[model samples]
Target: MKWYKKWLLIIVAIFVMIPLFIGIIQHNKKLPSHISFEGPTYKTDELEFLYDLTYQKNEERVLEQQLLGTALEIINEAENFLVVDMFLYNDDYDRDKGEYPNSAQKITNALVEKRKDNPTMSITVLTDAVNTLYGSTNNPYFETLEDNNINVLITNVKPLRDSNPIYSSIWRPYLQWWQPSQEGFLPNAFNPDGRKGSIGSYLDLINFKANHRKIILNESRAMLTSANLTHDGSSYHSNIGFVVQGDILKDIYLSEQAVANMTGYTLPDVTFKSSNETNGELEIQLVTEGKIKKALLGALAEADEQSTIKIGVFYISDRQIVKGIKEAAKRGANVQMILDPNKDAFGIEKNGIPNRQVAAELVPNKNIEVRFYDTNGEQFHSKFVIVTDEDETTLIGGSANFTRRNLADYNLESNLVINMPKTHVLTKEINDYFDRMWNNDDGQFTVEFEKYEDQTLWKKAFYRLQEFTGLSTF
Candidate 1:
């Protein structure tokens, strides 16, 4: 070969090999301490299940939101120290869409008021970098919280595994040095009229990982929910939550501390009063990252002929979870799922690539049934699964959706695993919540499987490709 041709071939090989090497190392790198964690199971009597619902009644949308209200109440009742980690904490929405509740503003006011009332109290708010559009624009909410002496930390998601490794591998080596700045003319992908973002912001956005944990806790109690504090565009989206008081709060605090440590912030030292009692009726465990997937799989594996599995989630495209559901159905367990139709993202239409294709794969079994929530202009953003046997009920829920990005250690996710007797009030309440939506008792909540069924061959191929390669967002 000619000398010049040999050098050119070497250069081409280098360009291809660099990203491949980076992608492999980053995906399997040793995560920060306590990334994928599973807290010990604690028994306690203080477990409350709360949910929010938006349904059409008499041609009008009726909102029955309880999770955010309960979260605000928790914020107001904190006395000494407060630690909150929310995925979304901004009020950016389409202003042309009539009127919507300023949920983020309400949370800010509550935090500021509480800070004013207790000047010595320690308050820390942790949120994802997406709220700032990957630091291209300033977040007003973070500024307001900092102005009130509240510590606000944007989680450093770089250390987390790259979900979209194909793009992130190239960007990490070549373009990650381009820091996002406020001076840019590119249209923001989230909000068109919002502050324009820089090329660096768009580059960072393609990495597609986040600290997607919605949690609030003081020394005494903690609440884990699927709802974000920013509800401007999704105020009426259905959601769910759980409030508990016990040693589990320590586990939650420790999880947040791990994120804080990654972000170079130290959380205030606040000791929790543990309920030493272990045999209480309600048992709870805090699971994060891949642990959430483990807990769900364990619960599903235990389902048998006499068992029933109920899942209500915004997205359900994880392969293992899909196989688990099918195996459970094959074992003669009744499996019913309430899924969003993969449509309506802040007034933007979405192609039903995932859920519709997944539902098509699931509904063939006689024991399995699937239904899509009847969303008018909002979404069914709840994420929880309930598996009931003759003796006990297992409920897994929090911010983690059943997706590769959310469950496979790619994103920082948090969830709670609650195990209680069949007769427990919390279990009954959760079952009732599912039944109301499944049966549409007095409300037009869910539609039949035929409503949005899609068996498109290309979409199925696309969903499989996206789920396997982590190329598309769930």
Candidate 2:
């Protein structure tokens, strides 16, 4: 009967269409980022770490397998010193307090264990003054650290701000000369014991920040990440850490340690044994920011002759970074950018509507490679990049992203760029990851830039204006 024939046709269509629909959705070249609140590890002659973490895309361990291996290797081989900087330090193991043991805790434990093996071996941890004051005690990681004799230092603090906005704003003229870095407009009512004589409190002021994250092992390996020392940051939220080896670790450690001293924090003299250093002709640069946060984007502009750029980020709010990515790819750098694709209603959407959409637009560029990621299922929350220059000097690791605020003028951002490890294994893994992301346009349900590229001129103009006023940061 005709009715039976219609049903059969419909059934066939449903079966065939389902596969097509999935195919359409699953195509994307952006590789599947790791899904773990737990930090990622890689191998290197020496291991490195970056700790201060607030956003993704700027925090995830975004390099190849070998790099992770290098991290583990550095830890295994640390013969001398291990220095770590953490903006957030927690010890409360109770899940009720926060989340699981983050990478910092793991590293802390590892350091303690390592110290037991070598009493002559020294371990130094520079934590933000804020951490010394804040966080839950359920885990008590900090107490263990203090027991271990790790050096604990707090950054400087100033005065307080008037609560009344009208009065606060009106009184600015008289208070203009008054600097919180020196003394706040008014002395804080309550101050911690160690913070006596300081008029302003560390909690009330905004001008000062001590965001620093790094982990260096025996001048061999180092890690850089955006994940804090909280539970949500590790098992529940998202975070990324990079492990680096070779000579670059020492340079980066030195720069960051210097910033710590500038913030009125006590620090030990840090320098690597020359015998352990590498002389790879690879181009390596160390960028850092704290009280003196470095210009992250300006450095990117300097990344000419780049063959490929691998970006993993947590938060991006810098406009200059946007322009730089566009400019770099437009100028022929094979840029593969991976981002947190949490476009759901529950998520806190960033970079506004138009700016957010521009992210989709940048994906399909002829020269650039873009992969939007949403791996909340496991854990792919981090911000970093794996960049290869034209001459083939690959730079891996750090806490910087090509965002308006991160690279230009916003929250303090720090990064450590080191020469690629001698082993080609990690580089190849990263390349493969990028290739997967670039071609799997539908595999990951990515938004196509081509779809929006054809928008009319007027519509584009309207969206551009919206980008400036509508969005806070992406």
Candidate 3:
């Protein structure tokens, strides 16, 4: 063989082999094993479980409830330290929608004001690089936070497992080195503006993993939410949030620190001890990815003929959870699920891939019933599962989508488990919310399965492929 020809072959092999190795490393990244589903429970009157809904009547949009107000109120009252990890934090919407109230900007302003009031206060914000399209575009919200001295850490998700191997294999070796240069040729997929992004950004988007948690921690309290402080999400979705004050808050703070450590950020010196105060007999547990999945499975398995399970989710494509629900139903457990139609995303139409197919999977069981949330061009973005029996009730919820990527430790997530008697106020609140949606009380929050039932073979197969491969946008 000619020497130059052999050299060219060797160079090609290097490029191929390097990316392959990187993909392997990312797929097998180590996960923290110490994180568990056991946490302290506070019995204070400070626990706030809130939900928000956007509805249109007489052609006027009305926010039925403002759940995020609690989070903003927490920021306003903070005096010592504040730590936040919001997944989405931008105002980029479809150009046709014009402009909306920038939730990220609101959060930025709140942090800036708090810092100005107490110059010595510590503030840290952790978010995903997708907000910047993997460095292709700049995030003005994060830039503002940094300028105001609020420490901002974009989560380094590259160290985590690759959800989409086909994309990451090429992205790992070649595209990552070339920064995205928004040549203004192609339209921005996220917003309505005519801004463009490079092919590198598209490759980054296809990697299919994220830091999907939303949390806020301060000296006064801590909160975990399923809502993004982004304007698009704020205006057109139904979301849920929970706030707690006690030793559980300390556990939550530690969980936030663990996520920061993954991105090589040195967390501030903050120690929140468990408060020895009790208002009732409620216990809270902080559960992340694997732990969250395990806790959910355990709760589902606990249900029997006399028990019932009510699940409300934005996405529902996890096989194990699906299997658990089916098996529980087989055992005569009453299983009811309210799921988003998965047909709308800020005016963009989706194919209803996972949810519709998943509903089809469950509808055959007599004991299991499913319904579609009547989103009216919005998304039903709540994620909560409640298992109830005559004696006690178990509530598990947070920012997790019931998808493989969100449950298999491929993406960072946070969920809370509250184990209490069936009569507890929090338990009653959760049950009532599920009941109202299930019964279509007050407003038409849900519709019968016949309204959007889909059992096509191709969609089912496609959903399974994406769910198993972590290739879908759950």
Best by lDDT: 1
- lDDT tens digits by residue: candidate 3, 1-474: 999999999999998888888877777777653333345555555577889876554556667656567778889988778998888877776757444566777788899899899887889998987788666678887888888888989887776677777668778877777666756455677875736777767767788888888898887687798888655444568988888887677777777777777788878887564465766577777888778899899999988899999999999999999999998888889999999999988768899989999999899987999999887767899899999987999889998989888888778889988888888888888888889888867666788998999979999999999987767888
Tens digits of per-residue lDDT, candidate 2, 28-62, equal: 11211110011212223443332222222333533
The candidate maximizing TM-score is: 1
* lDDT for predicted candidate 3 compared with the true structure: 0.81
The C-alpha RMSD of each candidate to the native structure, in angstroms, is 1.3, 19.4, 2.6
By TM-score, is 2 or 3 better?
A: 3
- Could you give candidate 1's per-residue lDDT for residues 62-123 as a string of tens digits? 88988788888889999879998998888776665545688889889999999999998999
Clash numbers, per candidate? 0, 97, 4
Candidate 3: deviation at residue 239, Å? 1.0
Which regions in candidate 3 have their CA more than 4 angstroms from the true location? 1-22, 32-46, 56-62, 182-184, 271-279
Q: Residue 165 in model 2: shift from native, Å?
A: 14
Alpha-carbon error at 348 in model 3, in Å?
A: 0.4
Local error of candidate 2 at residue 420 (angstroms): 6.6
